[model samples]
Target chain A: MNARGRIPGIRNQHQVLFYALSTCIWCKRTREFLEANNIAFDFVYVDLLSGTEREAVVEQVRRWNPSVSFPTLVIDGCRAIIGYRPEEIQEALGL
Target chain B: MSEIPREKVEALYQRLYEEAEASGYHLNPDKEFTLGLVESLLINEARYGYWACPCRLATGEKQKDLDIICPCDYRDADLLEWGACYCGLYVSEEVLRGERPLQSIPERRPPEGQRPQEQPARAPAVSVTELPLPVWRCRVCGYLCAREQPPAVCPICKAKRDRFERFL
Candidate 1:
């Protein structure tokens, strides 16, 4: 279950890592935005994880966002964008 | 995820809309967005045994997650400052008037370990004779009232009695 759910986009120009909670509307919107833009990404529903796996995932998210808020997008494993800022997301992906 | 019915979501939406209006608060006028948050509230309510804010992760313990509960402790401040609560379910006058663009706000809540403990509320320090009744403040909305006991439900935010703390 540690494997993330991957959405294949028309182009995988950059490795996009998405951390989200399935119950969060903002996360949903972020997902919709990425899909609409056809950006390939890997996402995990943090809430659905349990036990040590959840802790490991939380640490992963904490590295990018100490607040650990939802819809965290990590582009190329170096830059991370917090929240659903469409303009920032586009800029990060160089779209 | 529990399968919440459309009627369940609609009923709660109508109730919250009416209650918010009655208390001089405004629900986000984007009906679809508001209803999405409402539906998430139901999911959290069923999963956590309380209505945790959909945008924040809930630890599933009522005591630890109390402040992040729906209509969260930060709601009023967020509404006042950002024109919308972090989750955007509740909005401010500016948003209601279409003067402010509604969007996701920064998380005012600190990380789990960084959070400050709830304010100390063991006893009232005011002179009973001078004030007659103690002042109780809603930790969520900052509504204050002088009374023997806090109201069963907060008139302004509708947070339950336990959410009230003695202010004076």
Candidate 2:
């Protein structure tokens, strides 16, 4: 679940990594949206991780975007989308 | 963290209900969920000595987190614009009445760098009997207490220490 992988048929060939909190309603909605669209994505529940592991993951996210908000979507390892913006996610993923 | 007694939490909830009624504000309609959040606030107060938002990570630097205390500075605006606060513990009247659906609210607290920097200051200690204690008011429930400092948790509203403002 930690390693990035390819999602077949995604137009941009961008690997998607979802950082989310297990208890966050918005994160759950975002996951449902992706699933409903038949989009293949990998997600990590940040809250479920151990303290040290969570800190490392959060640091990684901070390096990309300082807000460190929930439901952050990393595209192709470089482009990061903060929050659950469905329109933005669609535009970024070309879905 | 020490476990907070259920009775304490219930007392706080009752106070919150009264305060909200007086202020024309509405708590979340989901009673069980609201109770859970209040319980979390109590736990955080016990653990951290302040009632930090249970949903957001606190850096443990009071100055840096002045905006994110439970009943955060953004709650009123959030309720006005989005029908609910960031944590949905507080909601607009329409949402309480089921006239409006609660929607996801974008984070309103400014990012770390954009937040106002804390100014440094110091106050000399005074004898408790010599000076009147500062009065702190809970923004959420309007509970007022006169003490040298705000309580770790609002006994009435369960709002965090930072949610208190000096009234006198």
Candidate 3:
């Protein structure tokens, strides 16, 4: 709940922002899981961004979760989940 | 990324296998997946002069990416705790024997802002001083220290003791 800025993909009071790394296996799995479940979400490949942009995004992620690990999921702009925990993501999404 | 020939990748896999064996380590039990990771590593090495971990992003600056080289600093601890490294390329004995399941490992590398500043290069010197303690080198960050034993964990790179190599 320490996150800043408005969450993306908001619909029906539900919003999801996925932060990932392009080559990360867990990130890919999380993406596939969200898509398969028909969940609307926005994602940014932290590794694919330009140096400055990547730093800024990483800083934002750190603010939300100090770990700043990949596949970080932000739901409703307040609830943040670190790593690809399917059960947690599912619960957070109310799926 | 340029395509690496299958034969070349296989050759690199063979070498990596032998090296792992020699180092008293084991590759992941999944052969196909391990081979795929090896191929990716080869591709990264081709793109970047050094063999960087395929799972992690590399800055293409050797000094900046020292901790992400093939045998990354966290490999030992990851294998010890999670039965596999983050990428699952290296595994613990239990995982290798199928006695344990590979699990996701937390990132041990500190964030960029928290990472220790790179040490400046040493100036040329001719004097040699003998020490009673053994010298150990951290393969990931290239940190070298002479002590009775290597640190339980690398101070700079956070690599475990197994990651250290005898310098002398």
Candidate 4:
């Protein structure tokens, strides 16, 4: 019910946070790729947030991606891979 | 899945395809993928008051968002450099012909602060200076018109008049 969405997966090796726009097709692909690979992750639809909540989330994303592009994947609080980069996702999560 | 209807998505897809073709531009040949982006564009148009690019997060204010409209200000450059636009909706002729693969591209539009300010109004091009009317260029599709004001809608890409900038 909250802005953050969680999907269950058998693999939990890395803490994955995905910042995305609900209207972004690449964001949809990124979610589907995770689901297909059974990679657990938390996602936020940045476009759906309003007011201060939106501002805070935007700042969080900007820290990881200066462009604030959709489908930005932050892994284990260490590295961020921007765009729907499936290979990077696979390598980062070891999926 | 989004609540937007399949028929509505298909209709816009058709319209865009026709418009792109007429303008010597091409759309992605992947129907399902293109339709998904089209659906998002519709979602944005309904939510925001204009057809915002599906991939970019819109601030929901039409004035601040004028550059990122569906056929965004960067579409032509992105299409030339990457073969596909930022959203993969518009593709280059090579991509359409399968000579090149369409893939995810880095965002070309810089962050808000880093964006280059619009250039100062320039003197009219010397060759066209004698012409009576001023020229306006559509930032989206590069359509040019000689008139007192930019067209209310771009005849080629259908972008709003605000997307136009003085050319000469």
Top-DockQ candidate index: 4
What tens digits encode model 2's per-residue C-alpha lDDT throughout B1-168?
226788888787776677777767788888876776677677767656666665565665677777677677678778889998877778999999999987656677777666533433223343454556777777656689988899997876556676676665
Please give the TM-score that candidate 4 achieves against the real structure: 0.93
DockQ of candidate 3, scored on C-alphas against the true complex (2 decimals): 0.21
Score every model by TM-score: 0.93, 0.62, 0.71, 0.93
Query: At residue A11, what lDDT does model 3 achieve?
Result: 36
lDDT of 3: 0.72
The sequence of per-residue lDDT tens digits that candidate 3 reaches over residues B35-77 is: 7788778766776787677667677787677767777877777
Name the 10 consecutive residues with the lowest summed lDDT in model 2 chain A. Answer: A1-10
Question: Please, what is the whole-model Cα lDDT of each candidate in the order they appear?
Answer: 0.87, 0.70, 0.72, 0.87
Candidate 2 error regions (>4 Å): A1-13, B1-23, B27-55, B58-73, B94-101, B110-133, B139-156, B160-167
Candidate 4 local lDDT, A19-73, one digit each (tens):
9888888888998999999988999999889999999999999999888898899
TM-score of 2: 0.62
- Residue A17 lDDT, candidate 3, scale 0-100: 85
TM-score of chain B of each: 0.89, 0.68, 0.72, 0.90
Considering DockQ, which of the candidate structures 1 and 2 is the better prediction for this target?
Answer: 1
Residue B5, candidate 3: alpha-carbon lDDT: 89
> Which numbered prediction scores highest in TM-score against the true structure?
4
Which model, 1 or 3, shows the larger DockQ?
1
